[model samples]
Target: MKFSAVLALSAAVMASAKSVRNHYPVRRESHKKGASSELQSQLPAGMAGFGVSNTQVTEVIIIWTNPGAGAPTININPPAGGAQPPAAAPPPAAPAAPAAPPAAPPAAGPQTHHVTVGGPSGLVFVPDQIKANVGDMVVFTFMSQNHTATQSAFATPCDPLPGGMNSGFMANPNNSVTPPPQVAMQVMVSDPLWFYCAQANHCGKGMTFSINPTAAKTQAMFQSMAIQQKGKGAQSPITGGAPPAANPATPAAPSSPPAAAPPAEAPPAANPAAPAAPPAAGGGVQTGTGQINGNGACVCAVTCTAGSFPAAVQGVGSFGGMAGSLPMNMMEA
Candidate 1:
């Protein structure tokens, strides 16, 4: 009776086990359907069909089967003919630095040049040529003889330029004057400047100077031209005045009138024609006694009666006595 009881209990347990196995398959099918639906809903819009693939489902199942595995790498390829997500933008770059400043200019300064005029070297400008810039000073110190520092033209070295500078004749005769004479000329331009001594014959002797001479117009060429000009120079200052004038001539003397004949005088009884009154004594006419003439006219030995003529004619006709009046015939003679 105990055996029979054991058999019945075993049969009952077997039947219950069969029923559980049958229900497990049906429940598993439902769970799979639900999981597929949920997976499709979670997928991005338009990617629902991607999850429907058996391969994608298997991958999902593998991922769920191993929960302890490292995170899965999902590489979602872009759909054909569909807009894709924009890639994340890269970061921006940094800024640049500033530049440096410029440099400054140099300074300007003036200078001076010294020159000797007519020194012991003779009629010349010692160091006759020099270079000078604008605003520079040129001091010309005279040494000997009478000399001048006069501005001249390059073309005509001996001739003075109109309105040009001139240090009038500075005479240092024998170089005896103290401190001598000096002339200061400022360099007004960078071009060539010609100068010469204006004293007579000095320029002709090659006494010349120059400032800023050039290759084409050198100081030697200027001196040569000055010498070729000979000793001619500007008017001399020694006269201290203008030129002089001319002279004039003199006048002649006047003539006198004739006097009336005096009363006739009787002839001397001793001689037929009174011996002609003794000829007046001196070389010129002399006064003598009166004599009667054959024509009954008074005859006097002198050309005029004493005291009869003007004072101007007193000693003109007679040597020692006053002049007298003459007869008309004698005056005519």
Candidate 2:
């Protein structure tokens, strides 16, 4: 709304006033090329006060330069506030408790050390790089097409802005909108850093740039990040791979004692159940009527009857007269 008012005032000034001058907050910035409205180009990292809490900004003043104007062709004015009608105005906010420290003057820290960036030919800013010292300060002031001094670093591996990095607050929604980012930038290293449009194809061609106190190996890194980003744009990510399943440990089987021997020529069932005893070699035994035959080596049950089991135990209860090996066989012989 304030911007609309400033624009309205601009149109109004173009009509009657000899030279219109308005007051905006003060700021420091750089020059750009082919810019439509008076605008400041690329700003620094902390200008919007992202990470560093010790940072501060004082003012923002928009100075429109007229082509072929008189002595003071410059019209420095603060952003106007009458754009939105009262109907559009928000209700007045209730006053709150005074600030603990109260409001300090705008000149809290060093208000100098100008940082500005330029585009390309047929563009607005040139080189489009803004660099500053660690302790130095910068002020930005401009009004032109959609532009910004994004307050995030050029992360490696081209990782998308981690959840909280890019605030998305300063990015201009529309193309021709001018959202001036008055921020203070400090180059921690004498080395330069590169930045680009997070937008789709805007930075791919030649819309990329760098900032450093001195020339170094930053250009190579920038090119590397760009290449990786381009590769990701080619195809989708890998699929069909999942973490391996865990192997469950098998439980150990319980060990058992060897089988006992069968009783020697036992009487028939009517003779009464015999108590089980240790097995004789090459023999079988019975426990509470359960007969346990010894295998050749490990005593389990039965004998070499390995190939295919008989329909019944070979000599089991021969006393029943089913097998000729019964004691009655001896009597009959």
Scored by lDDT, the top model is 1
lDDT for each residue of candidate 2 in 218-306, tens digit (9 for 90 to 100): 54455345545654432212212234566897888887977887778856568566788646654233223233465343322232212
Best by TM-score: 1
Name the lDDT value of residue 152 in candidate 1.
Answer: 71
For residue 284, what is the lDDT in candidate 2? 34
Pairs of residues clashing in candidate 1? 304-324, 304-325, 305-324, 305-325
lDDT of each: 0.58, 0.35
Model 2 scores a TM of: 0.28
Q: Once model 1 is optimally superposed onto the true structure by TM-score, how far is the C-alpha of residue 215 displaced, in angstroms?
A: 0.9
Task: Residues 119-198, candidate 1: write the lDDT tens digits.
Answer: 68898887788877665556566767877777778989888765565655666778775555554445556778888988
